[model samples]
Every structure is written in C-alpha cells, then in structure tokens.
Target: MKATWNGVTLAESDDTVVVEGNHYFPESSLKREYVSFSNHRTSCAWKGQAHYYSLFVNGEMNPDAVWYYPEPSEAAAQIKGRVAFWKGVKVEE
Candidate 1:
C-alpha cells in the first residue's frame, strides 16, 4: 500500500495492517522528513489512545493528518506502532 498526499508519496509498504477500515503503514515505511509530532490525540474504546502527526510536503502542511496507537489495547495490538492517514491523504493498494 501507499500513502500519498498532494501528489507526494509519503509512505509505501507491502506490509500494512488494516484495522477499522484504515490501512496502517509500518513505521519503517514513512518518510520521516515529512512528518512531525502533533499534540493531538483521540481515544477508541478498543484501540486505546491514538497519537497524531502533522505532515508536511513541498511546503504544504497537513495538520493532524496521521495517527497511530503507540500503546494499543490487546484487542488492537496488531496496529501498535503503525500509522494511518486521513484528511485528503490517499491510501492505495
């Protein structure tokens, strides 16, 4: 799968975890230079807490567009350390 935004390929990996209809890319697949920590968080009952990341590419900023569960509940352990994107970011096979 590949994660693209503004025509930029931000991440791509053959190995991705799908959970709750979202494809979670492995941390190793991300373009770290285009990512920065975001002070945003949301919680899911089964997934636990999710932390967010802001994406920047070609001078464009996509705030809180990426999220991941650093420490997920047992039910969602498979997605731990994997990231998902939204808000106009496209994930394609």
Candidate 2:
C-alpha cells in the first residue's frame, strides 16, 4: 500500500494493519524527511492517544494528516507504531 499526496509518495509498505477500514502502515514506510511533528492529538478509548505527523511536501503542509498510536491500549496493541491517514491523503492498495 502507498500513501500519496501532492505527487509525492509519502509512505509505502506491504505489511499493513487494517482496522476499522483504515490501513495502518508500518513506521518503516514513512518518509521522515517530509513529516513534521504536530501538536494535534485525538483520543479513542481503545487506541489511546493518537500522535500526529504533519505532511510537508514541497512547502505545502497538511496538518494532522497522519496519526499513530505510540502507546496503544491493550485492545489496539496490534496497530501500535503503525501510521494511518486522513484529511484528503490518499491510501492506495
């Protein structure tokens, strides 16, 4: 699977976890250079706190486009350290 935006392939990985229709790509798939740490956060009782990564490609920024559970709840342990996307970023199988 690949996560793309603004003509850039931000991340790609064959090993992914699908939870609630969202594809959580392995951390290795991410392009660290294009990702900037963001202050945004969200919560899910089962998943714990979600840390965000803003996508900055060619000077265009997409805040909170990527998120992950660094420390997941027991119910969501399978997706820990994996990243997922939203807010218009394309996730292609």
Task: Give TM per candidate.
Answer: 0.97, 0.96
lDDT tens readout by residue for model 2, 11-91: 899999999999999998899998998998889977899999999998899999999999999999999879999988999
Q: Cα RMSD to native, each candidate?
A: 0.7, 0.8
lDDT of 1: 0.93
lDDT of 1 by residue, 1-93 (tens): 999998899999999988879999998899999999899999998899999999988899999999999999999989987999999999998
Please state the error at residue 47 of candidate 2 in Å. Answer: 1.0
Candidate 2 lDDT score relative to the true structure: 0.92
Clashes of 1: 0
Clashes per candidate, residues 3 or more apart or on different chains: 0, 0
Report the lDDT of model 2 for residue 18: 96
Candidate No. with top TM-score: 1
Off by over 4 Å in 1: none
